[model samples]
Target chain A: MTRIINRQPAPLGRLVLATLPFILLALVYLLASDARLAENPSDKLLPSMQSFVEAINRMAFEPSRRTGEYLLWVDTWASIKRLFTGVGISAAIALLIGVANGMIPYARAPLSPLVRALSLVPPMAILPILFIVFGLGELSKVMLIIIGITPIMIRDLQLRTDALPEEQLIKAQTLGANSWQLILRVVLPQLLPRLIEAVRLTLGSAWLFLIAAEAIASTEGLGYRIFLVRRYLSMDVILPYVLWITLLAFITDYLLQLLSKKAYPWYHAQLGEK
Target chain B: MSEIPSIQPIIEARQLWKEYGEQVVLERINLKVMPGEFVSIVGASGCGKTTFLNLLLGTQQATRGELLLDGQALDPEPSPERGIVFQKYSVFPHMTALENVMLADEFAQSALFGRVWGSARKALGKKAMAMLERVGLGHAASRYPSELSGGMQQRLAIAQALMKQPRILLLDEPFGALDPGIRKDMHGLIQQLWQEQQLTIFMITHDLQEGFKLGSRLWVFDKVRHDPQQPERFGAQVTFDLPLASEGAKQAAAEQLQQVSNPTTISKEQQHDLSNAV
Candidate 1:
């Protein structure tokens, strides 16, 4: 009998609405965990809240008896450093290659097709080859991430560079900028925000490559820790580690988004429409 | 007659024929622009005015011709000696007015990095601020181009272009998008800047009265003057070139404005002719 209104809710209402799903998910998980634990007290798949707390305390607070170092901190540090190194190298090379592809004919003629073909080759397929070439060290794991993400990032950056208004390039030339100067000055500043955005977009794939490489080999990493304990169905440690990786990814994405907003407000405004 | 060498015009074009494939854009353009001249061009859409300006800007090469700028052979390359402003898309939208103006200075001062660090940065900032002030945008230095009014953005674009103190300034319908009032203000500002800086300016506009008002000389781009049967065969050329008296142009321009405002009195034939002239 009453009329139904389909109007958008206010900010507070929207926030509550958004959080509702997460709260319901947690509630369902907790209930299932309780039911499983009541049926079988010795169950390890669905660990209790007390078990999670104990695991975190031991991993975070207590040093490893073998190496006299906190394994959790060690793993987190190792993974982060390798991730950044791989991503950094990829970003630097991609920026140059992408700019060349967009700005110069010689580079685009050869590199564009090569990058397209490389992007089609599933990076996971080359994991074994990378290990064979670089050995079972950090080099191979980092290389895997780089080879996986660089082509896509390069393609992204080149497209963005190409999409920029031709007038700016012309304007820069009239302002006394040489070809190299134009690329370094006018083109680079504009592409940076887009580069960061491209990096953010490819992070999931980057992390996947990193974890897969770690799980297959390596002695110390979040991925290595999870796989090492998997034989005994150590869901508690695995679950926390997965959540930790997700948390780290979220923070990285936020920091990058913040950097782009602060450094290139104009780019963000341009993208805000989309 | 043989005692002195021939005086070179600031810009000289000889048999400048521009084409794309079989399509002729600009045909047989032979003209000279002397130093300190305010030349305005008017034309209909697709008459190749933009293409001509591009040639002047060094962004495009003429299919056949020898172009001389400042008595030197014109190459198909852009350099800081010539500056330009388009109808729109002039300023970098991602930067503030201050950053936009300072970008060229930064690049020129430091070739690769394009950053002015420490005291040098401060000195550059002061210079950029002065340029912004020259363009009547000193107060809006921190504002983004998107935040500025249309006229303000144009002024910022002018400031950015003038940072290098270019030998020649090219404006392609620079104020075409502004309102009538803002456009009038812009006209005054450009006039003042031109006189103070002693700049050589070439502007392309669609309004005949605007061209007549602002320019010392006017170049008309029209396909009608070439061939009606082969209208598409030929693009445009400098069909009519006329110099305006400094005083009479203002008065005549005012008269033309009044005449144009009286739309009801104008016959259909007059409107048709006006449309064709555009």
Candidate 2:
């Protein structure tokens, strides 16, 4: 059999292709909401798009009556701050240990097994332990993301570092790089794009851990709001909040992909599929 | 003329035997390579060619005996004193050709960030560009190694290796992966660089023609004392060391012809001779 495929699609074609699925999904939701509302005008399980828009506008655009501030925006800031802080620290630690352990055999021999074993222990299972240890503050929540995601990130990066050509390492050494210089110059630059990819992969689990912690106990977050409004059957607010979270995650992933391509053009070029 | 410095051996390996407790890999390998001499080591697969190369590169420690670079005992770690070009995957794939060439200069100035500022960066860039142009990669300075063709990648590898101005350059079948046309071009480039740089080179190659064409000295590695009863008793050794400067071409031609006729005959001959002597 023969095949014909275009590697580069036109912008309009791409745009259509990207939005077609979303458009269909929106249609399904709208139809489902209409049927539910026709049966029961006050059904909270399937709220109309008007209600969704109104709920989001009230939460995002208008100041809350109690707090005198936009709750949605506030939640965005707080949640993102916590998420990025934990992820940033995790990436740094993963890079440090991953490069060292990957490049040096002695470091790898003992540490790799421990990292692999710990990554297996479910982070949610340790959530209560972390809460007890760190208390019901930002510390515990952030600790969840770190402990849940860092070991896997470290392992991901360590494997990348290990897969690095021995020729490159030897070449750097021959160019007068000591171990420190080798890691810093040759290995680190190469690892950055991979680190971005690793972070991207762990973002889902990171968010899962974050939401789990927030749902269990937290004053304010996307998860806290969704679970809070769940008691009152506020489907309008919950649905909108869920969509907003999805949007934020999408934007983050896009930005990271953009960063990797921009900062490391060589990597993108080699990937063969933008 | 700089007083025509009498032949000084830049690299010396004395009875360098490498082995595990149960297996002997290389045994009693003795050789001296002079400065500015292109020496080629030829052998069949599994004949300790890479092992000998690694021993010289300091990646592998000989189980016994010693290796000296410039009359000093060579430390068993890779250093700037020796540069190497492999068959493939030599250049840093993540960097542009120019960046790859300037890596050593950057490390020399600042080991941490590799940020050369002001006129220094300009100077290094110029030097690196010159090397790239010398290797016929002037237009490919910004291309990644993956983007370059196999021949171009080999050229980039050579350029990167020459960045440090090492005393000796090691090439482990650098052109084996290239097409014949490109290999011929690479041969010219290597010979030209060797002449211009006054470089001492130790190249490991399995191809007899390529070994004869690029190098001035030839060393053949093979297992000589192959006793089926005690197969691991003796490892590969330098069976023939022919200096191309003097009547060496004839010896290389003989070995090449012999290789073509029967690849295993040399090893068998050496084994028979060793057994008779024993």
Candidate 3:
């Protein structure tokens, strides 16, 4: 069995470095907030000091409330279940269409120009058109997200497939491997690393579109909740939801990196570095 | 050696012609190779020796002639029946030595086994191990091609070709990449393997010494033709069938083998005296 080592661990020095910036920012904010706290604070410093403190606090502790309070506690089990099912269905559909279109030459040739043109039209630009067609429903939001992500995913997948080594393909041909066999045995193994990279990138694009999708046409979801808070200028709730989205994106990207490393160890070995 | 089988010729090329955009590489080349017969084609750099090997391996198609294998029309497709070991040691670098040998077995059984990993895998693994042992690479089976020396890599390539159970082995300068000492060892290993398997081998090399050491019958491609009417001709083809005895005789004969470096030097007094003495 191969021994996997933990590359990063928390030590006193790391802990100090992590907290140093925040600590200095807090001190500056406290001193400017009041003349008594600093020995001398002018009227011009008061408003700026209050805003800085609010931003700092918002950044520091907002995520725990979003994940622990809003996502896990208030939303309950049903809401989390719906989020996963919706995302899973969207990802599966996008992957199937992307991979199929990417692999077929004629399909890619005819559709690539249209897809490139569509990608330039921002997800938000289609909101009014989508709402007029599908109404302000869950389907409209999911459709919007899918349409926004499919083109990017397809482009990435196509580039990955095209970038495969010619020698491997020729070897497969000389070995008497047919089309399907070539794809399954030779192409797929070589494409795994790039495909995983595409997935990570597309996943980020999906999240960016998620907020737009929900803000325009949806009654529920983390994005909808954040939009509802924005109406009242409730920075606390808005900050927390944004924090949740960022954390989820980081976790998903990290998971994909780990999975790619495990599934395509040969690629990493070829790179001659971890 | 084992009993010489009365089987038909393994490879036969008749009036074979290969050309690249009006430059005729080879023309009207006819040859037949019997089982267990070791033949070496020695020629200058552009004499189409490699092209001939490629034709036999089915990697290259003849421009205007017929090539047959055991009385059947040669298929313009690569198969395990004709294994090729190239000068570059064309073994897959990512694969271990054992895996390279096992690739042939895998390809042979793929049709019937349908990629199932059971008896076919076990049998191929055993055969690969035995082949590696024969090539003196049993201990290095787990090592990648890059980790092995040049001679070891060539040995592994030979073993892989042999593991395919090819009817005839085509080697295009298999030991041309090795040093002189390593080349001699590889020649010995090739001779031993051919003797043990009774493999019909056709090798192409510019090294006259290697050809003489390994080939049972040596063929030289000279541009000067021997015509009765003309006392001297600029271009002709000369074929020498030297007898192989002990190492000393083989070495001496190899030294006497003339190269086609200069077409005009064909009638050199030294060559005339050597030819007359032989």
Task: Give one digit per residue, the lDDT tens place, for model 2 in A1-274.
Answer: 4445647668999999999999999999889999999999999899998898899899999999998889998888878888998899999999988987898899999999999999999999999999999999999999999999999999999999989888888888889987888888788989999999999999988888888989998988888888999999999999888888999999999999999999988888777732
How far out, in Å, is residue B210 in model 3? 4.7
Cα lDDT listed for each candidate: 0.84, 0.86, 0.66
Better of 1 and 2 by DockQ: 2
lDDT minimum window of 10 residues, candidate 2 chain B: B269-278
In candidate 2 chain A, what residue range of length 10 has the lowest lDDT sum?
A: A1-10
Off by over 4 Å in 1: A1-6, A63-69, A269-274, B1-8, B93-96, B102-125, B142-147, B225-231, B246-278
TM-score of chain B of 1: 0.85
Q: Write the per-residue lDDT of candidate 1 for residues A1-274, one digit (tens) a residue.
A: 5445757789999999999999998899899999999999989989988888888877878998888889889999999988998999999989989999999999999999999999999999989999999999999999999999999999999999999899888888887777887787678888999899889998898899889999999999988999998998988788889999999999999999999888888777766644
Ranking by DockQ: 2, 1, 3
Q: Predict model 1's lDDT versus the native.
A: 0.84
Report the C-alpha displacement of residue B231, candidate 3, in angstroms: 29
| TM-score: model 3 vs. ground truth | 0.64
lDDT of 3 at B61: 89
Clashing pairs in 2: none
Model 3 chain A: which ten-residue window has the lowest total lDDT? Answer: A70-79
Model 3 over residues B1-278: C-alpha lDDT tens digits? Answer: 23435776777778777777645667666777777788877776656677777778776888888889886887786665777777763665556788777765565556543243878688878978998999999999988776778899888878877765777788888777789888878878989988989988888886655666677767666554435664332232334545443555655664556453464423344444444434
Summarize candidate 2's per-residue lDDT along B1-278 as a digit string, tens digits: 13434475789889899998988999998888878899988888888989989988889898999898877898779988899999877888788899899989999998667658889989999999999999999999988887899999999999988998888899999988889899999999999999999999999986666676677887888888898998888899988787666444645445444553335634555434323322
